[model samples]
Target: MSIRRRLGTTLVASASAAVSLLSAGQALADDFSYNPPGTLVSGSGSGRFDETIYAPGMRFPIEEAPAFLNSQVWGHGGGSGPGGSQCDVENFSYPWWDNYCETRSWDMPLCPSGQGHQGQDIRAKSCEKNVHWVVAAEAGSVTNIGSYSVYITAADGTRYDYLHMGSVQVSVGQDVEKGQHIGKVSNEFGGTPTTVHMHFNLRQNVAGVGNVYVPPYLSLVTSYQALIGPPVEPAVGSLDEVSCDAIRGWTQSPSSPEAPIDVRLYFDGGPDTAIGHPFLADLSREDLCTAIGSCEHAFQVPPPLSLYDGVDHVVHATASDGSSNAPEVANSPMTMNCAFELPSGVRRRVADLDSANAWHFSPFWDEIAVSDGILSTIDEGEDLDRTPRLVATSSAPETLYLVDGGWRRAVSDEIVGVAWQFHPMGAEIISDEELAALPAGKPLRARPIVLRSASGDLWLVDDAPGPGSTGPGGLGGSGDDGDGATPDGDGDDVSGSCDCVVGRAPASSAWTTVFAAFVAAGVARRRLARGRRGTRP
Candidate 1:
């Protein structure tokens, strides 16, 4: 199989859950950015690497590469040579430039970084400097711009570092977008420059340990495709929300004006369609709207269960630098719908804590998951559709589903945290805070649940049946319509009346067939007797 396919097919451990978000925001929010338990190699780094930790919400570091990279030439999995070492020279059949987390670099006594490769190594199509622009993987403040290295720390404390940078564009303490150009690719170690290759690494904070290295091969490989055309964010909810009052608003990308970040919207994850007429005076988000310029586009919600068929859908948004080629997911926030569906028969009881609001529900589905954030019933597979699943209910053994599972919120804005999980019962809402407290790499306990909504309504999602019906009794019992509206109430009577009674069959009608059978037999016997008497005379 091709290298990228191999990497993509090898599903990361469930521990590597969540690659994107389906929130009201427009940007893509993924669960785990770099695929983890990343092929561990002993020779890439010249030092002791910490535990294999997954960093969620990361972006690919390289901004511009071929739309489709030569997967066969270079990718994860080391090259072969003596002792399966020498990643570059070992595979004569394969190009030397392609290697990630390779064990071949183990004995590079010259490279004292570590024993194993801690990051992904990327080389431009040909040996060229100041051509391939390496950008920030995700928007974050720059820091620790070293001699041959640079680090961009995301708001969530996830860190991205690039090595072998020739000319740096961003300074420490500066903010950047997902694909903002930061520098050119070249060997930059001050004294001795190695190959003209950019070695990329990621550092995510573990529970007790801090900033451990994870492989960026898959993340890089995936991001490499953004150059192919408008790339759909693999996971959803990576977008930022553009709020307006009339259940509608016009949004633009980059929040800039200079070379206003031009973009195209792939509504419902369809082909890219040019959105909006031109850049209007976008005063939407005065704070983070691009400084250069932006375009204002209007989006309206299709009717429920009608827009994209009532199931949650997405708008795979890709922002560009107005150039036909320089497009990526940097400034634009893809949007998702956060749909809230309530079950019938459950009493809208108030929770113990809040009073005014009853807990209605809003499940989060991840593009249009990017567009809206609400969730719907699980798909045909019953698998958790949304990455960083909103509610992974244990419907079957070892299977977590989004259906009958989601947040208990009356409104969308009430939901919080970088990620979330819920106990099957409504008793507790597992926040990221609680997750940090728990032991890492351990399974959360499963329980039948009753969730409370943001409006204080109790969501009885337990497997057991809900409280019995309180409607008008069926003819025989007390004919009270539980909510105090009797049969003779002064309301427009919408209830239909029945002509036949629900109980007791009529006795005569029931025995009609049997009575007919007896009479026919008697008549036959009498006719026979009369015929015999006449013949004898």
Candidate 2:
């Protein structure tokens, strides 16, 4: 028999849906960040929307640590110095900018404008030129060389260009491995030095667009993350239960999955203050086998006697395998209000709503109020498992619902596929009548906002903005001199920083009405505060 499929709806169904959903006043801390595609420096043209990572697994162009991916023309020590030396610490910091279409007169079909700058500019380890080594992003051969450019052509007809180098390492037609030394980053603009940075470009045969310069900023960011590894402590686990009897949780590092990591508990204070000795998370958990691809990563420890006082206390957990600043597991910083007088039976029920007990509900789930008095009078009638569980009807097996806390929330494809990383195979099959008995809760929503301003700032505004907050601005430079002309020497149609005429155009207002709707929803108060900055060229 054919069964009807029921799926969870996404919060980000459309731009309008996103605005309405985000306007609901549900706030969360920023966990991920990225500049939206086409959000370029003001006066620079609209960026291309091609999200192709042409050179997947490609090495970061720079061959050292702490490389800054800012614009050369608008960055410090360039045409528009942000009032500091090139070696300023802020210049080396992150939230990198995209300069591919940053104002130039080149035939770039992919850019919103038919003509624009053709490549991305990357700053080396420091302000100095010809010191940091530039490596081959992909395994390819040096096809051609110019006074200030070296081109590597992969077997797939994908061209990788490296510009403005001091010591040219590889010769033309020479085979080189990925990450092989190609040259040193410099400011050799065919004799006249422009800026001490590397101009990198990616050219490939796009199906519809033909041979054109694709966006490399996203690709570079991906490869760079692979090179440097995840931020500080990238632990992937969660704190499951906390009670007067004992505290329970699990943790594992993606970097080292096979080995068990240590989980430390802190009370009242943050990670700096540990209440008791660290507990080794080596116990096996059946659910973890599918959730995290590992089993022996569970931990259960008794609450310290000192926490038995009537006052409520907050507890946090951090995983450690040697790295400093180990990240806190999910559902952490849970609150404990257990007193010695509370019966052991009631303690378990209080722990079942552990997250609700501390207002630490997952961003996917809405907050529910559960008071101490409510927990003390709990009568153990039916033996129901309060832990999160997946349920589906045999009549409509495809439709999955997350049964938790006497309520059922439909699980969407995105929720199961990405947000919570839940495996649908673990869902418990039940009769349709049984599934209808549970009370319905609000639809689950994954937190993360992708907001585009009237100005060309496409922000991934994750966290809640303060009263006077502002979106992360562009290069915030006053100059319009973006890699003015193509330096002489390269036979190909490549471009870089040079002494040439530059022009500026007014900022595009086509998106103003669309952006206004978001502001009206009060989801983008930060964008409304700041006036439009630069015009597109």
Which candidate should be chosen as best, given lDDT against the real structure? 2
For each candidate, give its TM-score against the true structure: 0.35, 0.39
Q: Cα-based RMSD of the predictions, in order?
A: 25.2, 29.7
Off by over 4 Å in 1: 1-60, 67-100, 104-115, 206-210, 229-420, 424-537
Model 1: per-residue Cα lDDT over 67-177, one tens digit each: 111111232222221232111222212122223334443532212343455566665532344556887777677988989999987655667888888779989888777
Tens digits of per-residue lDDT for model 2, 396-486 = 5545566655655554332222223343454687775576566553222231111112332222211111111121111112111111111
Candidate 2 backbone collisions, by pair: 43-535, 43-537
Error of 2 at 288 (Å): 17
Taken over the whole model, the C-alpha lDDT of each candidate is 0.35, 0.55
